[model samples]
Target: MKLQNATVLVTGANRGIGLALVRALLGAGVQKVYATARDRNSLEAVTALDSARVIPLQVDVTNHDLVSRLSEQAPDVNLLINNAGVLSFGNILEVPVEKIHEQFDVNFYGALNMARAFVPAIEKNGGGAIVNILTLVALASMPGLATYNASKAAAWSMTQSLRASVSDKNIAVYGVFPGAVDTDMLAGVDMAKTSPADIAKAVLHGIETDLEDIFPDPMSTQLYAAWRQDHKAVEKQFAGM
Candidate 1:
């Protein structure tokens, strides 16, 4: 889990939290980073961060074949970051079923795809870590973001299962739960938000300190504390949001 000279691969690295993570990794002195997006051209800025260390790749995480091929390309990847995600706004009953499916595909299945492809390689390389960028809402459903909440919650469960499965393999699985961030993903939301850079730094710090579950932002940290005290109360609060 040491960041120094670690070769890492991060999905959806073109912008937002992923891009911030890439920059943070560079600052931490990582040897190389495979930054992936659906479009290679969209990654120009990310690659420009450190042209030599940042290797841009085009990949749709939903595509099994494409995700599977990444392991072959980045055989030296010891750290994998499952950061690609999608969001849809709607109540569960009224949301378009297709939109629900799309969110699940990216938020849940995409992380699974990347983990499946990389875990073996990481094991071969003598242990490493898999970081899943989940959300605070995963622990409590927000009515407005119904589908997004469900999908991320499922991923949170998967992250735990993955951790237990790989416990003896020397692979560490870290789940990051962040509250609202100032990113394009929440462009119009009028709420106090943490910067993606701060979230990225916190995530790397969690890994270095061996924190299995990371609440990266202030809001998430406070909310998680409340949830631990009374999860049902927190659930009701989110339900009304």
Candidate 2:
């Protein structure tokens, strides 16, 4: 769908890829962007844009009631970006189960809840787009981030399920798999990471191209390519890492 005059909602708009996406949408002439964060004041960066165009919305995606309220508030939304995510970097067996549940709470169920709440709204406002910001870990689980991997993998599965069920409604579902991005989330990672701006730009391009699965970075594309050849090889490689 065209970005100009699009009413977009981006979760986790306080930082990282979500923040970059908000800026990119504004640059693409989006008329209104509902930039959401758990803390409303954290959306100051979006206010740095045209305040009239960027609406700071306070929301905890995990909260069912709040999400319904927000969906009702923005019934005209055309583009929904499920970008609110948290990563717990550690071995799953070693960490408390609560940590795994917490990751799933935000990363997995959060996206699902948002999708469920916004589907009718999107369908009502002429078919729109829903972008789920997943991770490379969904393709191959890493040793250090087992919980995060599980959460994203579940989300990736749900993305496909959602697409199959919603495409008939004319609402497009795009699964975005971004590799290591230059963000606070990858603070100590010793890998080459792409700029969030570049990822955001590529994502918009992918959306325009109507790609169902969007690999927004070279790293993600490369890994996906490898997985296509030998899924076992990629799994073994990440398992060792």
Candidate 3:
């Protein structure tokens, strides 16, 4: 979709990929961007990028009421980017049940909450797109990040369902699967990571090009190519990581 003059709402825009996305949207000449975080004050840096264009709002995506209210407040939004996420390091069997729930709340349900609340508003504005920020591991199980993988995999499935459900409504759903991003979320991981700025730019390009599934970095593109050839092999490869 054309981003120029598009009104967008980005969740978790206070830092990392979310913050980078806000910058990219502005650079793409979007009319307005509602940059949201759990605490509105946390968005100072993001809003500072363009005080006139960036409107900071507080939202806990897990809270259905807050998301519903936010949708009402941002009635002009045509694009919604579900970028809020949380990660925990643990194997499925060894991970605390609460930890799994915590990750799912932010990574899976949070995205769903925003989608449900915003789809109608987007439709009202004559249809647009919903971009769900997922991960490469969602396609293959990684032992160390079992819960994070499961939650995002569920979201991947949801993205497809959402796409089918909204196809005729002029709404598009894009799933972004990026490999290790150099964000605070992966600060401790020792791997070659793509900068968030690059990922943000790529994601905007994917949307403009109408790529339903986006691999925003070299690593993700390479892994996705391998997975399509032999997914089981990819699973085994990730199991050892």
Pairs of colliding residues, candidate 2: none
Q: State each candidate's clash count.
A: 0, 0, 0
Candidate 3 ranges beyond 4 A from true positions: none
lDDT (0 to 1) per candidate: 0.96, 0.92, 0.96
Residue-pair clashes, model 3: 0
**lDDT by residue (tens digit), candidate 1, 88-132:** 998989999999999999999999999999989999999999999
Q: How close is candidate 3 to the true structure, as a TM-score?
A: 0.99
Ranking by lDDT: 3, 1, 2
- Residue 70, model 2: Cα distance from true site in angstroms: 0.4
TM-score of each candidate?
0.99, 0.98, 0.99
Error of 1 at 213 (Å): 0.3
- Model 2 regions more than 4 Å off: none
